[model samples]
Target: MNKKVFISGSISIKKLPKEAQKSIDNIINKNFEILVGDAKGVDSLVQRYCASRGYYNVKVYSIYDAPRNKISDKFRFEKVEVSESVRRKRESERQQAKDQAMTRDCDYCLVIWNGRSKGSYANILRAKELKKGLKVVINN
Candidate 1:
């Protein structure tokens, strides 16, 4: 089976830096599967780039029943299930459900941080805690 990489980043990052693109290119060249979230900023940019490159081995994870933004409908959609308590929580808290699931499922992780996004930092910490090989690109 192909390796799976979780690509996550700060919601504040609206563009991909050269380093981030290079990391993505490496993953694509290796034909690894990609797991990404459904959010604006970096997530949307990544989705668009992957679609432009014709890389379809992607799964967009969401906490809701459907993704808010999926650049390529051909990519698979995964709705992570959380408990009622989590569902009732704040938006970021609820979103963590999907992030945790992706962290658990991926063999590797690529995070593009804008230097101050708590969510991106959390993903990095979670990946380290889970012992997944992780590369972080600081965009700021």
Candidate 2:
């Protein structure tokens, strides 16, 4: 089976830096299956890049049944089911469930942080706590 990589970053990042693009290119070259979120910012940019390249080995993990932004219909959708209590929490808390699910499912992870996003930092910490292999790129 192809290795699965969770590529994620801060929602505050409006652009994908050269480093991030290069990292993604390396992943694509290795034919890793990508597990990503369905959000604005980095997620959207990542989706667009992969779609532009016609890379269809991507799965958009989301808290809802349908993702908010899936750049291509070719990508699969993975809905991580959370408890009712979690669904009632703040949006960030709810989104974290999907992030955790992606972290659990990935063989490797690439986190692009903008230095101040608590959510992105949380993902980095979660990957560490789970002892998953990961790379972090500080975009800020």
My TM-score estimates for the predictions, one after another, are: 0.98, 0.97
Which stretches of candidate 2 lie above 4 Å from their native place? Answer: none
Report lDDT (Cα) of residue 61, candidate 2. 94
Candidate 1 lDDT over 1-140, as tens digits, reads: 99999999998887899999999999999999999999999899999999999999999999888899999989999989999999899999999999999999999999999889999999999999999999999988
In terms of lDDT, model 1 sits at 0.94
Best candidate, lDDT? 1
Worst 10 residues of 1 by lDDT: 11-20
Query: 8-120, model 2: which lDDT tens digit per residue?
Result: 99988988898889989999999999999999999999999999988999999998878999999999999899999998999999999999999999988899999999989
Model 2 alpha-carbon miss at residue 16, Å: 0.7
Clashing pairs in 1: none
Q: What are the lDDT scores of the predictions, listed in order?
A: 0.94, 0.93
- Which residue pairs does candidate 2 place in steric collision? none
